[model samples]
Target: MAPLRIQPMPTYMDIHEIPGGITADEVAKAHAHDAAVEGKYGVHYHKYWVNERAGKIFCLCEAPNAEAAMQVHREAHGQTAEKIIQVEPDVADLFLGGSEVNSAGAVLLPGGAADARDPGIRTVLFTDIVESTLLTQTLGDDAAMELLQIHDSVVRDALKALNGREVKHTGDGIMASFVSAAAAVRCAAQIQRGLAQRAGEQSNHPVRVRIGGAAGEPVEHGNDIFGSTVQLAARLCSHAEPEQIVVSSVVADLCIGKGLMFRPLGEVSLKGFDRPVHAHSVEWSA
Candidate 1:
């Protein structure tokens, strides 16, 4: 499995081409069947969209695997999915928060400022919420929103403290960039540690974030960051346990003797990487 993932697990946005047009009642029946039996297959039917005039419908789900997402519909409702594609979400803060980053990809200290854009060499960071769907189901939208707000605040505060540039939100996660790999790693640890401590003493709805990072130049497009570095960071984040921080070899190399502790997990296979990547999990035990 690719860790706990930003959206809880691997997600597939399924496409259904309904030649006869799907009806509201028919969709309801399928949803009911899913609600009844999805747990059997370790899947969650997130939602669906209907285009009656065009005879097209889109279904969203979080499943252990694509096969599971397909099997649930095949066995339960006979609506075999035409396609199951893994997807990433698009989310970001209204604006970038923290001190400005310099042209040389250096973070200005607090109360300092710099220019607007620099897609230069940077340490990209990613973090995700665990089992968020279940949280939303347990607590209504209103309540879940409350917890998410706090999570955003905590993340933003940590980024500000470290002078990280808030790139965007990833639905249940956040993406930020740092000029220094050590700062990024330390900030990731801080986010996890602080949230863990708070979850320990707070309300019944606990919060956890999986943190991961990689170092390299990233391509900025469509107001979002991309390229292999960002993807690898997210892949590592998905491989991280709740309240855990994982970093790539690039990050590990950059943080050596920087007073950061990392345990090497040896060569491990990460999705989309040509070969297994040697990764390290940040040790955060007190």
Candidate 2:
């Protein structure tokens, strides 16, 4: 039997908070642009509402996938989305669950439902050294250690500026989390750009770093993140070129309608995963 299709199309939608100096009329034009792109992709876009208090415009769209939907938002709008969330495959039906079904899905005794599940909405970031093994072989332990210190200094400051929480360090790489996916993307980009500038100033061998990030539910345990989703984000770091940021569809969706840019790399399967994940390379602002 063929699988059931829930939504007519897969779309990434969000609520964008308009930056100061932008008028509602301007936002309407941007929304119209997004509508046109959705039509080109064979999807319908629904303009939900305009928040007068917070100065935000909310929209819902349907597209081929999250990336395509995000592309529409990024290309069409210049507003920063406060929250871009996945509507989920079958969110409506899930709400139909009664008390018995709901209780059955609860966490183990005393753990509560929270412990068994992640909030399902978080920004996951991965960072790692570039050419560490070769640098270690050539520069030896002493010099390599010094470079690592520089790497730490660069990322640590970027994370702080972005208000990110340090989850832990995976070898030379660090896994961090942010409340906002936009901040995570911006933070990673800033780190890379900062390191590049710092490297140029130093006369010695310049150390470079690569970063990867995703936004999704990572199993949370006592103020730390765990589970396969987090691992996938960490592994994505290796796939990134030096000074580049690779992010998953999850993160891509969360940044929709934000002024941020991205260049799609299509999709690729990560190790120990059953399916391929859509990934993108962050496009730096001009």
As for model 1, its CA RMSD to the true structure in angstroms is 18.7
Quote model 1's TM-score.
Answer: 0.58
Off by over 4 Å in 2: 1-120, 219-226
lDDT score at residue 220, model 2, on the 0-100 scale: 24
Each model's lDDT: 0.72, 0.65
- For 48-76, candidate 2 gives per-residue lDDT tens digits of 33433445554555667656666676666
The TM-score leader among the candidates is 1
Ten-residue segment with the worst summed lDDT in candidate 1? Answer: 90-99
- Candidate 1: tens digits of C-alpha lDDT, residues 31-63: 677767889999987655444444555565789
Backbone-clash count (model 1): 4
lDDT of 1 at 116: 28
